[model samples]
Target: MKNKSGGHRRSKSARNEAAAGNKNGRRRRNKSARHGATADDGDRLSKLPNDLLLNILERVDTLDAIRTCILSKQMLNLPTMLSQFFLSAGSIPGHHDKACLFSCSEVFRTNNAVARVTDNILCTRNPKIAITKLKIRFILMPHDSLTIAKSVARAMATQKVGAAEFEIRTEKDYEDCSPADLLQFAKQLNNFVGACWDTFAGLTRLWLCNMRFGELDIPNILSTCKLLESLHLTNCDSGTDSVLQVKHAQLVELQVDYGEFDRIELTCLPKLQRVIYNYWCTYEDPLYFGFVPQLSKLNLTKTGIRSEKILELSQLLANVPSLSDLHLDFESEKIWVIPECPKLLTPVLSKLQHVNLENLPEGCDLAWTMFFLEAAPFLKELCITVWDHWCIMATDPEFRKKYGFCQKADVNWKPHVPDFKHKNLVKLTINGFQPDDGFMEYIRNILEHAVNITEISLYDRKVCGSCGELAPEIKDKVCPSRYPQTDEERKQITEGLGLASRAMVHFRS
Candidate 1:
């Protein structure tokens, strides 16, 4: 009986050992599963090819792209491969907090973050890689500007960047901030350009806005950018300067909008094919164009015109012998006065083809309209938009003082008829057409002169809030026009104008 009891105790001990072993095995399996998950999550992005990764980064903002560098060991050097860098303070993550109370501290924090990311990428970029473009938009803080200038200089010193665009803007809260900061930023920019003069020689495009510089700096800066093809200056100024002259051989396109300069002279831009000039300020100095033989398109929007000046338009167009497309917006001002000398009215724009005139005041003599018809014998299309009362009231006071309200000139002061008819004119479009004697006479002159006219379009001034500024909430509620036209009026205009049989007429209200 004692031997049997010993054997049973040994079996019980064996069972206990078996239970412990099973528990240990289960623990080991659970640990393995946890580790497998972590390994699977380990830096899958690192598997992508470097070129593919760089392309992906290019589509994202530069701030986000730089932040990816810290993701893993493989991504540490990825930002160095970027060919294009675009940094904007407003685009930084977490910069736009949805809270109603946006504090100054948040602005500072956002600006600091932008500076840190930009400096890191620019400083660590591969010197051998050629950066094709670098664009930066940020507020003009004094210390930040200096830091940015230094960073740019360092990057330019190491890399072969082809184009650089800088946009200095004011913060939303500081829109009306003092000009002192802008002045300081401009000084830093001048210094940077001077230090990196040779590096900018291969630059193809340059754009700057809301900066101030001296008159002498303008020429100096352009002289270095010998290969620049396009230049745009908006709301820029030269301190205490009246004239800004741009002379470049390789420049193909130039735009100057709302710049605080009295006069602008374009002298040696032989390859310049397009020019856009728009300024609303009152200035009497004329724009002098010289040697621009390839100028094909000229757009003038709300440009100040001097009615007292003689042959102003003629002098401006004399140099652009190849001009084909012309767009002019008088901005509801009547400055097209008859020139004193008939010879001065003659401009041989033989190659001109398309003309677009907008915001022409009502009841004014058609002499200004006739000037181009007689000048461009090969013109193919002419579009005119008549001004409404709202547009007339919005005209600047200086413009109104210089050129009084629109009125027909004395009956004795009729424009001279062209020696040659408009044989090539094909299309005529008159928007906001009114049934007045002056307008009818204008149409009659065109019908009699344009032998090859094919189509005429007359559109009554519809109630159009599209042309005027309306509040977003009330835009849908407001009626477009107070007076709706009847179909009978349309028929009367068609019959009164004696629509030419060769031309098809389309009338719409």
Candidate 2:
């Protein structure tokens, strides 16, 4: 939610585009250095057999690969015989990346080029050579999409394609696009999907960006995509506070980023394994799980001010009993999740093995996190990081008050089981560790609770250059952190934890 990558990793098309951008005249010199000093280094590299050259070509942008093949007569048939193609309209020369960054004409021209090149390859490729992968990232332009979608549908019909994917992007980013622009983009996308339903049916992954789609538009698209295993919706929403009810059988993963829905109700996804929801606009609980039998991983990230009701995991994840991995990121905002009693949470979090709590506000109590230990009986690792992220934090007093920011204070929590001896907790990691009396006592308290713990790692506060230095007024409000560095200090800290436990405590600098 707070600036995390929705795309799991950089796609092949993005990597290829970056490589194509940096492939200058220095390539031959580097090639010569690698294959021994020789003047025929470039030729030697290019003259390799088709199989070896094709391997290198496939690693680069499809346009550059085509150009490389066009430069050599012997490699003319390689483009036609290639098994993979990743074409991105945004990567076109002087298109979205160059001086005409926001020019609509440039966008249209680049999309046309992408559609043309995609058609030339998919429509003319050899039938004997099966396409192992086909990916296209193009703008949602009407004419260009029609051409690209029809070519893709034809390729899917004529060629045996594996892992077919589409990453649809609007000409303008979500921040820059207006309401009319978003509506138009969604209309164009609907037309494209309806026009090329066959192409979308073969897609294994689809990422949509920047659209205010109709309430039913999303469900209709999902119905057409029978084989889609993953779907990502970024900055996409319907009207005011619409309830998003999803029921896809084959979807294995789902990501919703900054969506403006009141709540997402997972009706029936029997095969879903992972879900990531971030920065929802609604004040209610973000999700309700209904029938996700195989789901094991859930990551919920949000930045909330005060007045947002405490999120109760017991009710939200009541139906998702199979969850084994849980992560909650607060984005340095107010504590949102209430420390529910163990009896209520343990039912849904029974299989949970790992829990990561990130960006807990500095100076607040760590005692609230022990609720997880009391609840998830099978949990093995508990990791939490405390920091004051100034990048997202407003320093002005008026601005902070207007947004209803909570003052830095401890979260009032009392452990339900004061004498709880957890046997399954094997490790505990705390970042932003301090050597103060309260912090050290907190460590002692943890050692007393998790008697079976094997390791306790204490790390210094992570540096955030992007956050810069906090304002002078705000800096004084944060808790002073002085980690034990010298031997004497370490000895005193260890001695302070006398008779707590035998865990190997490491003071990681």
Candidate 3:
């Protein structure tokens, strides 16, 4: 407690030293204040509770959450304390180019910054690290192979694994997997959760991209995931003859993209609601496909099925009393099969609120409309994508003869509104619009008949930029006034805007 100078004898020099000390202290204080004001300020953050901060972090991606650590010392530990594990490699900061790097490449690099952070989280303690959702995206790079495999394994081990969505895309030259590699992949599913045991028992939803499994291997995977609710498989290397026997009663939605199926059987799936099958142009099938009682919607697009079989299948669907929405597309050139068309198969569908048909021959208008007249009595909406050139031909008798041979002047071919009065029909859409005399006559008849029709859409063919610039010429060709009387009525008819408004309409198909 003794002073450096004699207590009573302190001189001016001592006072000067005291003043310098005060100045030095103030300088240090101001320097800290300046730096803390911008980068190290923690006063405002103290307002939020730990729980509230965690909530905010949960909504963002893991990369952004980790960046919060730079905020202050308090935040440094908060990122690691998080219970929900998020493993998205693409969205990390400072790597904007790699943000959407999942597509268009084959070797993912694992030595990146995001992977290091992920490894830390995987290896950390704090047993609260429960992963509810796992999303992995890769470009199929060789360097990323080990990283992806390891990350996936870690996620499966620590997480509850509510959903595991894998998106793997490779270049066109990528070879299909050998049978041994696929089997090994399947076997690893068991190690994810020992109880799963090659069965995704806990997985309610599964999505795979660019995967390949043999014909015999598919059923094995399906049987394991008994509770699967949604299954989507796209561009898999599996052969078309692969028999997919899915009998899960809990499966509600199934979508197969461009696949070959030797035989697809569904013995039981009482809860199944929707199925979409997209086939390549080379596929040929007269085989019968079955469905569950609860099935409601079915879409068959671009399949190389014979036209006759399409009619048979349509008739077959009448048996599914609960079915409400059906979409069937056929190649324009295929000959249509006219089986003994059954009376609208189900009274439930007879009361159908909406119906949609596309790509059928314009000359087969009677056959096309007749199906609607019989099947959808309560139809409230109708859409037709007519090929204008055919619809515009001047009374082609041969055309009518070829399509059931009904004469244009024949009573049976007359446009009858009463037959499909459908008092409920409120909206009509006709795409691929062209204003030829024949088309004008058809429009006049449709407008006059569909009294309840409130709105009709008229859209031209989708043209490229060059063609779009030539739209004036194209319009002149299609809209020329061959018959002034008919053209005037058609124009006046659409004045209500209910006849020619350009709006996209969607109906049950």
Best by TM-score: 2
Task: Tell me the whole-model lDDT of each prediction, alpha carbons only.
Answer: 0.68, 0.83, 0.52
lDDT of 2 by residue, 180-232 (tens): 98899889889889888998999999989888889899999999999999999
- Single out the weakest 10-residue window by summed lDDT for candidate 3: 406-415
lDDT (10s digit) by residue, model 1, range 149-219: 56776777777876776655544322342467546656766776766565456556666666667877778
How would you encode candidate 3's per-residue C-alpha lDDT over 48-87 as one tens digit per residue?
7888887887677766777775666777777766755454
Ranking by lDDT: 2, 1, 3
Off by over 4 Å in 3: 1-107, 110-132, 138-161, 168-199, 237-240, 280-291, 303-311, 315-319, 328-370, 383-418, 435-452, 458-509
TM-scores of all predicted structures: 0.66, 0.83, 0.59
Q: Count of backbone clashes for each model?
A: 2, 0, 11
- For model 1, state the Cα shift of residue 166 in Å: 3.2
The full ranking of all candidates by TM-score, starting with the best, is 2, 1, 3
- Candidate 2 accuracy as TM-score: 0.83
Off by over 4 Å in 1: 1-135, 142-164, 170-185, 195-202, 280-283, 303-311, 336-348, 389-415, 418-420, 435-440, 458-492, 500-503, 507-509
